[model samples]
Target: MNVTQFIVDTYGAGTPLVSTAKRYRPSSTATKKGYILIFAHGTGFHKEHWEPIIERLYAHGGPVVEAWAIDAQTHGAAATLNRDAIDEPGFTYSSYHFAEACANLCKTHLNGTRHPIVLVGHSAGAASAALVPSFYGQSRTPPFSALILVEPAIWPGSMIGMADSLAYKLACVAIPRRRTTWRSRDAVRKDLGRRAPWGTWDKRILDLYVEHGFEEDKEGVSLRCNPVHETQPFINQINAVYPVAELDKLRKKVPVHLVYGERNDLFTREKQESLLRGRRFASVIRIPGAGHLVVQEAPDAVGDVLLSILGGLENQRYVEREYVL
Candidate 1:
């Protein structure tokens, strides 16, 4: 699929609160009936990761939805709010900050037309989307009309207060020590193919990840999102509250769709019911044989799910589709 790459300024030149995005829009006639879909990737990933899924969605028969995938602050080409401290170690990565930045970008750039805005986010971005509703409360017209969260970063209620736990502390330490450079992009791909999450990713998606996730350096290739920035959300609990209330607030006003991979270890069936059971406009589904990174594992399947959801939204039916894994 063809795309336009651009940067949206959030806080002017001095601040590092800019966002980089990839956008795809169908021909004018086909786009008249669709909502604007904004995709926000997880921590450490670039907007390019959303391309495969976008391609699959367009390939399948459906309403021609316009889509944009954004690289969050501290990731991809987006500049940091504090340019002077780009290499700082103790910086915090708050989901609230990401949500506000996303809202700013949508309001400033994507809201030019009359289409309803739908925010789709994965992992950390999913959590950020969850927070967006709270930030935009009921007083004013919400910038986004719907939300599609994939394996969000929300932990179980029991673990909400365990931000200082040993496992999280260990992740805080281990994540920062991750390798940031490689001899080349091919070398990075080969190395990541041998790693756990990356090993599970589809080759094309992984290639796209490397293509946008890294930048050439004097020595070799280094991660655009530094380890410090990528690891902040894991260790910092300053913004790690449960999002049940936030989701509740969003469900009342707009459709809230939750998609989880069946093999995902993060979300349990009980948790799904607890969060989405009988809400006025909420639904949940599981993708068979998939995991937390379902977008990378099965872009076509993810795309099919998204198209189905979009169809439902357009028809005001909230229809459900079945995937065979």
Candidate 2:
């Protein structure tokens, strides 16, 4: 796959700029009917984390033209770019910022594209993905033809009390207190390899995180995304619940699919059901031996599921055309 890196200056007066990478097979023969995929990563993760699954998607030979991944202003390469602004005291980042970046990419870089655009996001990234369409306003047509939310972290307004949940505590307390600086990449890799979540991650994803999720300096290497910045979205909780309502609105316009790991660690059964209440989805799938971090834990399974979803969409389009004829 050929890769290209670029930055998109988000719209609005004070929105932070976001970094993006595009990947495509050099020999791809896909035309307008092929899908153009846009991806958003979870909090504390970088865009490169999705590369493994993307590689699998390419190998599956789905109707894919190209794939694009965005780094939230306070995560990955974007975090390095916005260090000054984000370092400011009281600076807070929200899912809205990520959503604005996705909306900006579609309005600018992908403007007037003919291919069907599919937006895929995992965990907190799914919140941002769900809110992307709202940024276009009611006057404009949303760029996405479909959405695939992998273990979406979105919750209804009724679940505002989730701040007291264990997941919230882990995000706000444990993450900030976790080790950040390491003596060397080898040391970091060893430490993470023995940890709970990291140890559970696919080796390829773990390798990607080690490569792209940190930066080297005089004091050794540290996480590219400051732990404080990573906890901001969890602390703010302002935009977290908004995605639920947005999903309700968007489902009528585009097919919205949900993918869950068989294990329900972060989001409990009741919490997951909250997202389904009074809303219709195109499909719901579950992958065994994975949790909320399904993208990192089971990339191959994710790729297989995505290919099936894409094939279904293609068939649906064909049937619709035939009906029109």
How many residue pairs clash in all the candidates, one count each? 2, 0
> Compared with the true structure, what per-residue lDDT tens digits does model 1 show for residues 109-206?
75456667788999888888787666554685455667999877765465554434444466678889999899899999989999977898988889
Task: Write candidate 2's Cα lDDT for 85-122 as tens digits.
Answer: 87888776678888888877777677766677889999
Taking all chains together, each candidate's TM-score versus the true structure is: 0.85, 0.93
| Local distance difference test values of all predictions, in order | 0.72, 0.82
The regions of model 1 sitting more than 4 angstroms off are 12-16, 27-29, 79-85, 134-137, 155-158, 161-173, 266-281, 317-325
